[model samples]
Target: MIWIDTLAQGILLGGLYALFAAGLSLVFGIMRLVNLAHGDFIVMAAYLILLLVTLMGLSPFVAAIIAAPVMFGIGWGLQKHLLNRTLGNDILPPLLVTFGLSIALQNALLEGFSADSQRLPTGAISTASIDLGVLTVGVLPLLTFGSAIAVIVGLNQLFYRTELGRAFRATSDDATTASLMGIRPGNIFAIATAIAMLVVTLAALYLGMRSNFDPNIGPARLIYAFQAVIIGGLGSLWGTLAGGIIIGLAQTVGAAVNPEWQILAGHVAFLIVLLVRPRGLFPRAVD
Candidate 1:
């Protein structure tokens, strides 16, 4: 029973991890432009939500809803005016640029919020839990898991069912060719990033609600997100979720055995996955 409960908790925790990686996965899938500032952007969104909640006495959900469009605009402008220029055969430029962006965001956040950790006040929801026959689960965790699924499903639908998705696919395959067809790859990339920022906003909401977060925590979150992305397979959304679950399970099981092993356990699992399958459990054919 203890083990079952542990596993269930771990699975729920994976939902949060999945949310962390979804936006990173989307941006990479579309543009292959690795945003080093991705996790920092998530943190930034959290702060934005916190601001709205503090200033207007709005609920966290409402604050997140308002933050979404603001984040989208920021992403769009960042890509359009800045990140797009850094894209090319040489990935070094974007890497450098985003790295700087990450540093700048961290410094800015530190200056504004100080070094203290913060969490959104979720009230009763933070303590709410559901009883299953075999095990109990937190309502917040369940909601996080559900949101992860919904985000992935929504992204899949947008990618497979919409005209814009077609443009995205075409542009990703070949920017020059896409441009010839009257599809502006640059603009499409910006829009994809904007969409990704919306996902980031969702992720940020859950992140703030679930745990203590600070500006410096972004890099750690990025590592988890990146590991999940790699473990699942690049450009594969469903696989990202699976990867998060794997890490979550490993961490939970490890902690059950010995608390000291929790974080190490996740890294070990990621290593094991890489050893067994270098390209990940579900490598998408990128051609």
Candidate 2:
């Protein structure tokens, strides 16, 4: 019974990780450009939400709603004016640029927010829980898990059912050819990033509600996001969620056995997955 509860908790925890990795997965899938600054952007969004809550006296949910468009603009301008220049045959430039961007964002956040950790004020909802006969689960975790599912489903629909999605697929396949067809790959990239930023805003909301975070924590979050992305198979959204669940389950089960092994166990599971299936549990099919 206890083990069942732990597994359930772990699955819920994976929802948070899936949120972390979704935006990263989207950008990689579309542009093959890894934004090392991705996690910092999420932290930045959290701070933005915190700012709105503090200044406007809005609820966290309302603050996140306000932050979403602002973050989208930031992402759009970033890709349009800067990151797009870093694209092409040379992958090193995007990496170096985003790496620099990551460092700059961290320093900027540190200067603005100081070294203190911060969290969203969730009121009673934070402590709310529900009983399921077998075990009790926090309402916040349940909401987080539901949000993760919604996000993935929405993204899948956007990818498979929309005209913009077709553009995304075309541009992803070949930027030059896409441009030749008047698709404007640069603009598409910017839009893709903007959409990713929206997802980041959603991720940041849950992250702030769930745990305290500081600027320095972004890199650690980045590692987890990267691990989830890799373990899932680069560019595969559904697989990313699976990877997060695997890590979550491993960590929780490890902690159950011995608290000291929690984090290490996740890494070990990732390594085991890589050893068994270097391409990941579900690799995106090549066209």
Candidate 3:
């Protein structure tokens, strides 16, 4: 029963990790642009939500509703004006650019918010849990996991069923040819990033609610996201979820044995997965 509970909690925890990686996976799938600042962007959205809540007394959910569109615009403009120029046959440019952006964002956040940790208020939901015969589960964790699944399902539908998704796939397959077909690769890239940032806003909502966050923590979050993405296979949303579960399960099981091993266990799992399948468990065909 103890182990069952631990596994259940880990799976729930994986939902948050999946949220963290989903946007990163989406942008990479469409544009092949690795936004090194992805985690910082998540933090930025959290701050946005906090600001809205603090100023307007809005609930976290409502604040997120306001923040998502704002973030989408930021993403659209950033991709159109800055990141688009960095895309090419050479991958180093995007990496260097996003790395610089990451540094800039961290310093900016530190200057604004300081090093103090912050969390979104959830009232009773923070402590609320459901009792199962064999195990109990927190309402917050269940909500987070549900959100992750919804996001994945929504994204899959968007990628496969929508006209914009068709544009995304075409651009991804061959940008020059996509351009020749009268599709604006630049516009598609911008929209893709905007969509990614919208997802970031969703991720931020869960992240800020789930745990205390500080300006300096973005890089560590990025590490988890990167691991999840790599573990699931780059550009695969469902794979990303599985990777998150793997890490989450490893950490929970490790902590069961020895609390000190929790973080190390997740890293070890990632390394083991890499060793076994260098391309990841469900790598995209192009990858």
| Pick by TM-score: 1 or 2, better one | 1
Residues forming the 10-long window of minimal summed lDDT in candidate 3? 216-225
Query: How many clashing residue pairs are found in candidate 1?
Result: 0
For candidate 2, give the lDDT.
Answer: 0.92
TM-score of each: 0.98, 0.97, 0.98
**Candidate 3 ranges beyond 4 A from true positions:** none
lDDT of 2 by residue, 184-221 (tens): 99899999999999999999999999999999888877
Deviating ranges (above 4 Å) for candidate 1: none
Query: Taking the tens digit of each residue's C-alpha lDDT, what string does model 3 give over 61-113?
Result: 99999999999999999999999999998999999999999999999999999
Cα deviation in Å at residue 112, candidate 1?
Answer: 0.4
Clashing pairs in 1: none
Clashes of each: 0, 0, 0
Prediction 3 global C-alpha lDDT? 0.93
lDDT of 1 at 98: 98
Candidate 1 per-residue lDDT, tens place, 168-211, comes to: 98998888999999999989999999999999999999999999
lDDT of each: 0.93, 0.92, 0.93
